[model samples]
Target: MVHLVKSATVPEYASITGVSLGLKDKVVLGPFEVQFIDVDMYWSRLSFHVNGPDGPKLYVVGQGESFVYPAADNQYLNITLTWIRSDTKTALIEIQSPLQKLLSGQKLNVGDTINLPEGFPQISIKLTSTSDTQATFLVTLPYGETQTLVITEGSGGSVRYKLGDVYSYSNYVYIHLLNTTSDGPATVDIYVPKVASTDFKIVREGEEETAPTTTVETVLVYNDLLYVNEKLPITVDNVTYYVKLVSTIPDVAKVEVFKDDKSLGSIILRVNDDEPKNVPNAPIKLSVQSVEPEYKRAIIRVYGPAGAHVIPILRPANLLVKIDASPKEMLLGDELVVVINVENLGRGDAYDVSVAAPIPNDFELISMTKTWSLKTFPAFTNMPALIYVLKPTKVGEFEIGKAVVTFYDDTSIETNEEKTIYSPVLTGIKVYGIPKIEVNGMAYNGTWGNYVTATLATQSASSSPLKLPMGTRTMNSSRMPRSSSACPAASMAQLRLMLEP
Candidate 1:
């Protein structure tokens, strides 16, 4: 026997027909509820409120347009507005879901056919004949079995096959007869089972085989918060695989897949419940649940093949702040330059980092940027130097305050709390005073010789100057005259006058 090879496509389990709704009227199809709202006649547009497992949303579609939305169990729904009756204020829509639901209140006449949605395990049912009290159905299933069932009113029938002397029930399809007429019409309810992610198997030569030996069982399931550039390691089949969030933009998340240390490739996912797609030739499936662009983060789920396990790793960013002041010792009223540098020493990246340099009271801020901020700092990276100038206003030793640094990492992004660290305090900064002095002098030429005249004064830092008694004297090259005066502080200023011949 020859084997048929077909690629797996998203399956549609059930389809609903004859759904009519008025303004604010709704119909439930599996996990989806579609309500009719007002319509725009000018634009030929109709509004609908769709509520499903994902969430409630408003959709506007024109007549004959179809929209797809996520449903329960990672399934999708295709909804189309078939017709709009403006006069009756009602609209007819068709909804299809990948999961099974109750198909009730359906009227079928003899020779009527009910075809299953386009997907795996294709099936169909037909009403062959109907009596006054019984109805007959011809059911076809994916296992290549065609069975006939005759059931009375308010009764149900199931398809089954014999295996090793025991009848095995095939729950692929179920039909319930609500009422029947001899003339050839019947009202019935149909049911189909939902196919779970791991429920189906690949059949070859009439033998049920598993999807890859490694995929026979769920090896790993990872669901958590991930920051941009953060790596999540999952081990499957003893081989470690990595999923790194490359970016979080709007509703899309860019992710890079890696095996061990080698990068496989990148893929972008829009947050939704669509089926998880495996990487090419890799036993890894990734599903992005949500994206938070404000925090540059995303919530992702990863499914690994057999023997899959996750090794929890915490990535905390270590930030170190260093403050340097040149010439720790300076004179009073002198300018000082202070530089602040920040470095990331941990395994994670830091975001929205702020560094504040507090100026002491004794020092005046001449001109400087007292605070600095960094947008993104990668691991083992150093930020540019933050410099500021300050002037000492007093003559004393003081301790410089520590620089305050606050930032957030991949873990703290969820709490919105920043981790704060401070730089080491700078001590032994000394400021000394310099003595001030004032001097004045004048010179004039006389008839006999060159005459030099000057006045000297002795002054204290906080007190007035004390002058000694003035004594007029003239001196020649043979002799020199000297005079001295002292201040209250015992500091003295002396003057000597001499004439050159």
Candidate 2:
């Protein structure tokens, strides 16, 4: 109808509809469509649409951008976003194990995963972070097992993860036989940390597995701590022998072998702490063959936990007695002072130390008692002297006999030790007697017939009776008044006759 109807101009406007979705949320499924309709001009346009049982649209959200997606009815959508900033903050991830190279101080960014190398048995690792910032990571193991680990910041940030339970870092004991005989009874000495008890097995070459032998007796030895020294007796078999420990490093034990009881030609065997992985039920084997000289023996050692020590048995004290006599060359009836000294020259203390000094044969005891007692005698020190005074009664050459010292050790066993010391000989004294003499003399004149007066005197100042009588002996001298020349010959003859005895 060409009727004069005026045409109206229509305005065009752009329309946009959006749906928000999170990366962590489930994807939207089912068919959906988006259409554009213009009612003013009766024109419709479908700008974007998605059909079928799939999501309507899928898109990724970049950094600092918002994303939207449609959610199901009556279900609250929970979205978790792990935003990794482009900042220059770095972290260190360290993987610690025995077989792999140490990943120490390895720089890493956020959301980066550290792959550890394959290890024997199974890999177990200790992870450490050396950064002050919190780090979040996802670990995927060899078997596609995944774990989310959050390592906190600072120097104390560390984590230990076990990939499988088939691996172990425990310590084990290996018994090595250097010179041994199969099917023979043997005694083994093992030095270990103090523990309850240990079970082990003895094996030789080419034999079937057998039950283990447990050590029941343990002796404590002194070291840095109380250690257990176990002595085990076992019979060698035809299989490989192994020593297993219930604990690990620092608790390792030692074995020793001696050629004889005197510890000569000895050798020591030990399992080093760095002897690879010490898996349970598997131990290092050290086999030895027969040795030369016919006196060699094997001594096996196994230790327990660390910090155990062994105390040695106490040793008996050694006592030494010494005696000294003053005035060694003394006369009879002289006082002699004899001193007895007791000394302990051993490592241990002596108890009930007693010293006895007996009286000599030719001497008489003047001082109180001859026995001395000491309750305790310290090692390497001397006790007080025991003095004995004696007087020689009748001595030619008398020997002061040994001074005996008897004492017991400070241990509970109470071992006894004794020592004897002999003194020097004492010289005898001499006796002197009074002198005795007899004198016979007579005073005479010229003639024997003539009357004469004579006087006799003794040589000593004190008067003593002579053998000839005390009274004066008179001899007659008839020619005493004769002439001097004639009296000389006669006087000489008379003097000779009167002096004759």
Best prediction by lDDT: 1
Which 10-residue span in candidate 1 carries the lowest summed lDDT?
Answer: 1-10
Report backbone clashes per prediction.
Answer: 0, 38
lDDT of 2 at 43: 16
| Tens digit per residue, CA lDDT, model 1, 297-337 | 78776766535788765678989999989889877667889
For residues 359-474, write the lDDT of model 2, one tens digit per residue.
76667888855447866675668887788788876535566777766666746334344533343433343311122354443333344455655555434322222123345566
State which candidate has the highest TM-score. 1
Error of 2 at 122 (Å): 46
Cα-based lDDT at residue 333, candidate 1: 69
For candidate 1, the TM-score is 0.34
Off by over 4 Å in 2: 1-312, 369-371, 410-501
